[model samples]
Target: MLIDALQCGNFDREVFEELKAGGFTCVTPTLGFWEGTLESLDELGRWRDREREYPDLIKIVRKAEDIRAAEREGKVGVLLGYQNTNLLEDRIAYVELFADLGVRVLQLTYNNQNELGGSCYEEHDSGLARFGREVVREMNRTGIVIDCSHVGDKTTLDVIEYSQKPVAITHANADSLFPHKRNKTDPVLKALSQTGGVIGCAAYRNITPADACATVDAWCEMVARTVEIAGIDHVGLGTDYSHKTGPNHLDWMRKGRWTRGVQYGAGSAAVPGKVAKPDWLVNIGALNSVEGGLRRVGFDEGDIAKIMGGNWLRLYEDVFG
Candidate 1:
């Protein structure tokens, strides 16, 4: 019952088949990032059609039971998620509206500041704003998971303190390991673990070490360190896999019309155009390597199970009511 907590790849039949073949029980697909309310809804509608188009391969998951049902039937459950709350804008009610639309996971901010809070790339973080706090309250009430992956340090801490329910730093790594802006600090990780929240370790090359060091072993070592800091129940796989995507998508992800000039995020400046993914964790199919890596690093079966997908399921059961 492997569950990938995050993957925003090119959504198609081939991708679905690959996930199905990889033994994925469920996955959270990012439906919103730079999109507004209407655009996000359009994306959601497309996903609805996809569910209809590939009924045998994919099913919509609004709760833990939906995930279990998909697993039982040998299909992958798709949990609708957002990488940014730009769609919510100033309207806090949109949280509930989108929650009703099956938006189970939402990241407060992307790489830049918005109505919610400052991004990780922002020079000065204002922490959680008044409107952001209100949105958090509504999300807590509506059962939408709070995500702070691309949020700034101060904002991440603020979210941990402000959220009534446990929050998630869904697809990120430990900054103490690689020291990237997208990675969370030790204090933030500790606080999240203390609150029973989970941090899904990402496989994006930018957040990890350079080149040869970005092997499955290195990632497992990072995970082991995370468990030492954040505890086993607070760690899992988010992967952040974005395979089969074109270069234009990368440009849009970084700039997103917010800047007239291109904003080279993380390792993009050196690579110029392409977004690099680690070879060992390239896509959902490579998830087995993660399990193997965990085993090599001496994580007992019980603890490895939690880090693989069980931890996220526990979180969903507690929060996705």
Candidate 2:
């Protein structure tokens, strides 16, 4: 089965190896979120060196061609993305720099207001700021896909209307099914679909409806609801797998210097509590790995193929190419 996974936090060699072993042809692994300029540069440098050292297990992917090539070679194509624009550090030039370094998808904000705009958890969403408009334009010019999963309602709408290219909300749920701040409302879904953007349904336990049991079938049902609202063409899977992040990581995310400093407002309150064990959190393992989950949901091969990675593939090609 095809899987477009997003791995957050520090990269683990063994975990990535397992993804390849388990049949993940392409994955969008995040490298920056709440990272400062210097830190991001250092991380990029390290990633560059690692890619050079381990060319077989992972290779940087920029275009749709790279993904196709990876599939042919039986290797996992690593598409670099960012969960937040912190690395931009109020500088628009960084967008191009990141694009050049193989970062393709960029989420505008995390959980609170930044220079770009308000986050999904923010109490008052004032939409995209002046600087955010410039950032969006620059991203379009650089061929980087914009993501709005964690952005506030107003900001998300503003971005959908403003972007010259189709933008994605890399990971989110339907708020109509589960009334959480992290989930997108019906109007937001319609607007996103209207723009030809894709909404990747996430699989976090907290984000799904509390009434819905925490299982692969339940998650698929939630995704079905999203498809009903946004249409199948605009929906895909983006399992925000924090498979290796423990309680310490959650605490870091909640109280980290990056989040505390920039993400202020009621939006920050929506962030989930830290998981005690990294394994306890959602990962491909939750569905007994990617292929298992698809089968459990009774998804036919074609439906599974589209939701697994085909939709994301089409969306990426349209925006990046």
Candidate 3:
């Protein structure tokens, strides 16, 4: 039972093939980040066609039970998610509109500040704004899981405290371990676990480090340490996989329409490419390595199962079921 909390790859037929090869049972593929309402709708529309094109390979997951059914049926459960709430714009009712359209998860911010709040990369950390608070409530009311992987610490906590449902840092690592701005801080990890929120540790190089994931032993060591901080039930695989694509895709993802110049995310002026991935677990299909790594790290089978996908199922049950 392998499940990715989130993945933002240039998904295509080959990618879906790899997901099946990787033994992925379910995944929350990022559908939008900088896209506006029309673009978002078009993206969703593209998926509607894809579902018809590859009916056997995937199933659009509208509920938690759908994920379980996907596993039993040998199909990849597709949970539509977005990295930003840009499509919602200023309207709270759009929250339910998106949920009705099969969007099961939404992040408050991407890598830039918006009406909801600040992003980790932004200059100021605007702890949830008035509109942001309402967005949280509407997301709760609509049953969309709130994500904070790229959100600032303060805003992340703000949503967690104010939300009736548990929020998530869907694809990040432990900051105390890796010290990246995109990673969650120890305090945030503690608070997240306390409130039953889960943090799926990414296998991305910038956040988890390629060397740290060089082997099952090393990878499990990282997972063990994260579990030590966030608890077994709150740690899962988010894997943040970015399948290599055309050169311009990075520019669109990092800069969007907000910047005239390139904005390197988790990278800098010297190295302006996507972070390197370790060879062992490059795609979703290699996720079995994580289950092996956890066992090597002395995690009991039950705890290992929790880390693999059980925890996320429980979370989705609470918000999307």
Clashes of each: 0, 5, 1
Model 2, total clashes: 5
Two-way TM-score contest, 1 vs 2, winner: 1
**What digit string (tens of lDDT, one per residue) describes model 3 on residues 221-301?**
888999999898899889888775556878888889888987888878887887667667765677887887788779889
Maximum-TM-score candidate: 3
lDDT of 1 by residue, 1-321 (tens): 788888885789999999999989889988867999999999999999999999989999999999999999999999899999988868988999999999899999999988778899999998999999999999999999999999999998999999989999889988888798889999999999999899998887777666423688877888898899899899998888886888788878878877888677765567667656787765668787788889998999999989888989888887885
lDDT of each: 0.87, 0.76, 0.88
Candidate 3 runs further than 4 Å off: none
Candidate 1: where is the Cα deviation over 4 Å? 211-214
Question: What's the ranking of the predictions by TM-score, best on top?
Answer: 3, 1, 2
Q: How well does candidate 2 match the true structure, expressed as C-alpha RMSD? A: 3.2
Worst 10 residues of 1 by lDDT: 205-214
